[model samples]
Target: MGIVSVSMPEDLLEEIDDIVETHDYSGRSELFREAGRKLVQEFREPSLEDRDLVAIVSALFPYDSPAVETKMTELRHTHASAVRSNSHSCICDDQGCVETFIIEGELATVSEFVRDVEATNEDVQVEYSLFPVDSIQRPTL
Candidate 1:
């Protein structure tokens, strides 16, 4: 292993520290190493760059954040052709809302939509899974 130096905003570093303490990470270095591995796995998987895809995208955010909701709506419109269906639900305890979309399109378009949702709000938690269109098993008539 080699040593490398990096910088982050103090507030962000503090958040990392909090997680490290809460989760009993050995130290910042160990925490960062694990995070780096997870990120690499997320971006380098399945290699479906040129294929048509079907995806499920979901975002969770505090229910009171209208800005997040509005941004999500704008992105949905911008990618309207890719979106097949959308559903919203409030968590039973009323603390948060989840929005889910079933989207089908080329890999690039689906990835762009998911990236936009992830960038819309730092507080929003976004998750998505993509499957190549040809890989899905279709029912025979």
Candidate 2:
């Protein structure tokens, strides 16, 4: 292995230090190594022959942002077959809007759409999370 130097914000570095201490990590190096490995695995492309996966991608963005609203609508329409359903709600006056996309389709297609949604929202500096779903499907209401 080779040594690599990188920089991060002070707050993030402090959080990493806290995690290292709390989780009994050897140090920043070991923690970062493991993190890098996990990141690589999580981002690897899926193959056509692979089984389709059910996934849920939840994104929270400013409800008042026209661009974000349009992007989400277009995404749902473009992937209607893969997108099982979409549920949206507003948490409160100050919390913006939150939406979840239920997707059931080929692994590669789902992954690609998820990445696109994340990038679009991130361009607006929105926060989001994507997770694999179990066989259970929520009833459309």
Candidate 3:
């Protein structure tokens, strides 16, 4: 690896130091390296409009029921373009239960479908975000 020098603001440097201490990092070099990797990944990720995007739809539901699965399947079929993949998980809660889904599809359609699901299931809390692939710029070595 090539050595490089960087000048950071005093406050920012102090903040970095705090993070290092809190996380028990070996040194600022390690922290900076990880930060750089994330920055590069974010920069290299494609814009949503550039390609078909995958969306992860996470939801919390009041109980585990076949109705939830059926509804989710119907929602996926109705909005196929917005759903490339789907998955569900069960969470046990004192009041009832919670189910989560990770879905993939076109950004706009997926977002709309998520909204629809939320509207249909009043007791379910849904969250979703899109990640575009096939268009993300790969970093060069």
- What are the per-residue Cα lDDT tens digits for candidate 3 across 1-141? 977798756877899999999999999999999998985664355566446666677767655566766787788678765555666655554445444445555555555776778866555667666666785799999
Clashing pairs in 3: 84-104
Candidate numbers, best TM-score first, in rank order:
1, 2, 3
TM-score of each: 0.73, 0.61, 0.50
Instruction: State model 3's lDDT.
Output: 0.68
Best by TM-score: 1
lDDT of 2 by residue, 1-141 (tens): 899997666877999999999999999999999998886676574432355667777788775877987888988998888898898778788468877888886667777777778777543333333444444479999
The C-alpha stretches of model 1 lying farther than 4 A from their native spots are: 1-30, 37-41
TM-score comparison, 1 vs 2, better candidate: 1
List per-prediction Cα lDDT, in the order shown.
0.87, 0.75, 0.68
The 10-residue segment with the lowest total lDDT in model 2:
122-131
Q: Any idea what lDDT model 2 has?
A: 0.75
* Backbone-clash count (model 2): 0
In model 3, the runs with Cα more than 4 Å from the true position are 1-51, 93-104, 134-141
RMSD of 2: 5.6
Pick the lDDT winner: 1
Q: Which residue pairs in candidate 1 collide?
A: none
